[model samples]
Target: MHSEVAQLFRYSLGFIAAISFVACLCIIALAQVFPWLCGRRDDENAVQSMHSRPTPRIGGVAIFFTLALGVVFAPTTIVQSYLGVIIATTLLFLVGLSEDLGFRVSPRRRLLAVCVASLVVIVLLGVWLPRISMPYFDLLMQYWIVGVPFTLLITAGVANGFNLIDGVNGLAALTAIGASVSIALISLQAGYDTMAMVSMMLAAVIFGFFLVNFPFGIIFLGDAGAYTIGFVLSWFGIAVLIDSSQVSAWAILLTLFWPLADTVFAIYRRSRSKKDAMAPDRLHFHQLVMRGLEICILGRKRRRIANPLTTLVLAPFVIAPQVCGVLLWDHNRAAFFTVLAFLAVFIASYLVAVPAIRACRQRPQEA
Candidate 1:
């Protein structure tokens, strides 16, 4: 029986992997043909004026289709477990596509869309953070009212975090790809086959998108892509924790520290500046890297670097320690404290570096 079960699991994984890869390729091909059909050319001036050209921002459409197909074709267990996630993700993709295509959707309207999607997933699908280790209390009371609201907040926050971080080439997509793979591996180890399969599908599609997004930027994930990725990842994270007996809720938090940290910092920064919290700005860590690279290159400094290098050097530094802490520490309290400490250090470093980076960009170049 044991051997048979092991073989079945292996076959399931292999089948899902093949399907995901093929779906990803199809999505890429469809995305490549979409811009011409829509009478949109790559925006040359936008590329020059901004960081990347206006490629067909509808790559999310491909991602959405592929992911849906992958999920629908997956094994019975995975399909049954992830049905709610699929529905929620589709709703978010629609919202994102509308925003991408010049729909006059306000932030409030977009947020409401997210809320509705999250509520459906939470209420009907029953996805949530089912457990958390409270330091003093023996067991945290599982209140439906409180849990529902909290889950909605997390889902909405994750969606916005991905959207907010999509300012640079390969930044958001690459991060999603990496994090999704990691989560999939962890879920596999924990014997959560359904969660693992969903993560694998997402990772595969995002990896294909990354090929066009990185180095020479040929496409952008836009709002649709970001929303889908965020919704799925957030749902996967919650599913893993809820299904596991050994894993703490803190593990999910630690794994996703970078984007969560950025979201919190952005809110605080905006509040401090007395600016509208929803207004966009170029003050993100990735934006800072871009500014630093442009300054270094134009200054003709002996030490010059590319924009990608800035992301490469900084993102891992922020993410690695938290992942290690989560994996190494068994106690939830210890892990939670460790994550909080890391967040404090990251925020402090950002505060110190932001001023210097801005000054470097604003400095007059040699005549």
Candidate 2:
């Protein structure tokens, strides 16, 4: 733990994080000065948009821009070990950024981009899920054939998952902050200084974006920001697990459970309706909560208030699973059960509370 703290303050990492924070603030300020140049601006017209006015959505550029600078300042060995991943995530972010810039990138193409990035990272870094904590699966996972494809699928799914949950103002950024810190804390506990630093650096970079995003919604996470967050964090989970066999993959998954859960639920919901799984919709957990607040208490015209409020209401839901995961980082059996328990709660909230609110919203207003 002492080493973790030292590493945090040493190797110019603290300076890099501080610089990244200012860098994000600069991006926000620049966007305000020249909004037209900052990719696309979003309003309430799109199916998934929650904001009332058009806002610049290319905040990912600032994040990766700062992240690359951090890599340059990192120790040579750390950069050598992670350069391939940084490249992969850069490509992934650019592909999503193109979409954010009002280009014609489809969801299919975006998913394909993630798959390509995952393959490069896996091949270059040799990162794969060694075991799944299950018996037969563990035996199968030991082989690259099973592990490689499984890792690829999961990495792509998670990259897209972050995109799915970027509904409310602070939901994605805050959830990313909480999960990254959890990963860093667990990495510190396991004496993996590199992993801890990477995780903490990520948390710091995202926090800079969070300051202007929450409550006021001056800027947005956009496709690039959301996808990059998922891409990096999901791979960070794999990287840490490979670095230390003691770390539970289930625990790692728990750290990312909030967005991943929403993605899985989205796939299931879309499948039930015979729609393409990648098709966009407004039935997301955060979306439901936003609508609920508008219909029940805040009233529909109060969206400016309800949007960020939805993030606050669900922030605990994001943090709790991460805390549980970090606390049980090395306990596979406990973490596995804890994952199942959280899923139960997640699904119940989706099926019960959301539908109840949907019914309430559908009723005719009294004359």
Candidate 3:
């Protein structure tokens, strides 16, 4: 126990120092370079939120490189064990960077690129979802056919989901930090030193990004940053689940609940509205919540504060599942049931809140 505590203390210091230094340097460099690197925001796409101007959307470039630097300099003995994950995540980052830099990469092409990256991770690293918590599902996943595709689907889904949730300033980065910290704790408690170190490193790097992103919105965590974060977290969650028997599947589910739930909700809502699932809209959960705050909370007098304030407001709720996951990490049955109940409550709240906000917005004109 003494040695374990010592190791964790050592890792914590190195993780914070390395990531913090790299993030600072990278952010300074990107602040100078992003104007040349990123194109003007294409608000016609309905993806860019209202801001003072078309700020740089290539903040992901800084985060990606800084995170890589932190990993290369990590105090862990098994840093090289993450080579496959790092490479695959870099590939996704490049694809996202290309899109941000005005490349006309279609949604299908981008999705395919993410899938290709996930395939490389699976083929090279052998990190795939082997089992879910349910006995029947776990049995089915024992077959290679079921397991391989299922793993690929989840990896890609998360990669895309990160991009989907990046519409709001600081939202994706804050959510990533919350989830990463939770997973790091879970891995640490399970004695997976490498996974714990890496997750904490990720959380620290993103928190550095968050410092500039929140309240003022000086920069954005573009597709590269968002996709890379999602890939890393998803990979880490899978690694912990596969390597540790003590960690319940519900822990992984809860770690990823917000992004996955948001993506699934968007797809279903779009399909019902006869729009393409990947089509951009301004009515996401975050967007609606912000709008609600704008109407009921901020009022017209404080409208400008809504964007940043909304991120702060929703961050705790985003992190709530991960907190629950950590507390129930050892109890699989209890964790699974709790997640189900929380998810149901969350959906109900979303349904009620969104329409209520819409009605609030319309009432003045109706009156």
Candidate 4:
């Protein structure tokens, strides 16, 4: 029985990866010629606009459609079981698709849409926070009323956190891939092969997109891709936690540590500057690091390479916590403390890097 299950799981992963890979190739081709096929993203009045040319940010449309089709090929049992999650992901995809097409989506409305999707999964699919790895919090979360709202809040926050980090080439996509891989590793360890396969497929699709996006910046994931990836990854982590008591909450958080950390720091930085919390700026941690790479590491002559190089330089830092989380996945208290330790290191590095980046920016041109 175990051998049969393992064979089925392998086949499922291969099928999903194959389809997603083809879809990514097609989307990349279409993006170059068919402007309307994917939403044309003119680099204007956007917080994350680092490029000068118009490119498609509709990569999410490709990913969403491709994954939806892939789900049809999923086992009937798994399909029936995960119906609510599928539906909610599609809804969130639509919400993000509209915005990628230059629609003026209000932040509150977008957030509300995410909450609605999250609530659907919670109420209909019975996926909610069972424990938070804290004695007091875990005790309180045992009550449905307390657990449901907390679950929705976290879902919405993580859904938006992906959007927050989509500033430069490959950052969000790579981060998503890392998180998904972590989820897959831990889920497999916990004997949840289905969720493990799903996470692996997500990582596969993002890896496909990453090829065209990074270094060259041919296509962007935009709002749609970010939201879809975020929602899928966050919910899957939640699902893994719910499926197994052995899975630690800190391990789950650590899987998604980069974006969560970046989001928290972004809010704190905005507040300290007396700016609106939702206000967008180029001062994000990745943005600062990219600038430093451009000025100091890459130098003026090689400045063009800095954008993609940022991903290469910083990916290890972002991925380190996920690795740690996986290593400590079975130990709740250890995982929790390790998460805090990694988070502290991340923040300290960010603070120290920012001033140096600013000085790099101020230095005269090297022409």
Ranking by lDDT: 2, 4, 3, 1
TM-score of 2: 0.94
Candidate 4 Cα outliers beyond 4 Å, as residue runs: 1-15, 32-42, 73-76, 300-303, 362-367
* Whole-structure CA lDDT of model 3: 0.77
Instruction: Give the per-residue lDDT of model 1 (tens digit) for 1-367.
Output: 3353455446544554455445545655675666442223433333222343345566677677767777554557767656767787777788878766656566667767888888778776765666555643324426766666777788778788888777666778777876786676667667776566667667767776776667555566778888788878877787787777666666666666677777888888989999887777778776666666666553434112454555566667546754653473345776677777888888787777778876776666432
TM-scores for candidates 1 onward, in order: 0.83, 0.94, 0.90, 0.91
Name the best candidate (by TM-score). Answer: 2
Worst 10 residues of 3 by lDDT: 36-45
Per-residue lDDT of candidate 2, residues 90-207 (tens digit): 8889898888778868999999999898888888877687777776788888688999889888898888888888888889999898988999888888878777877777887888
What's the C-alpha lDDT at position 56 in model 2?
74
Poorest lDDT segment (10 consecutive residues) of candidate 4: 36-45
Please report how far candidate 4 places residue 348 from its true position, in Å.
0.9
Q: Per-residue lDDT of 8-60 in model 3, one digit per residue for the tens?
A: 55766456645654564566566576664545456424553655555667778
lDDT winner, 2 or 4: 2
User: Candidate 4's residue-wise lDDT over 111-199, tens digit each?
Assistant: 88888888878777766878888878788897988998888778877878898888778999889989998998898899887777667
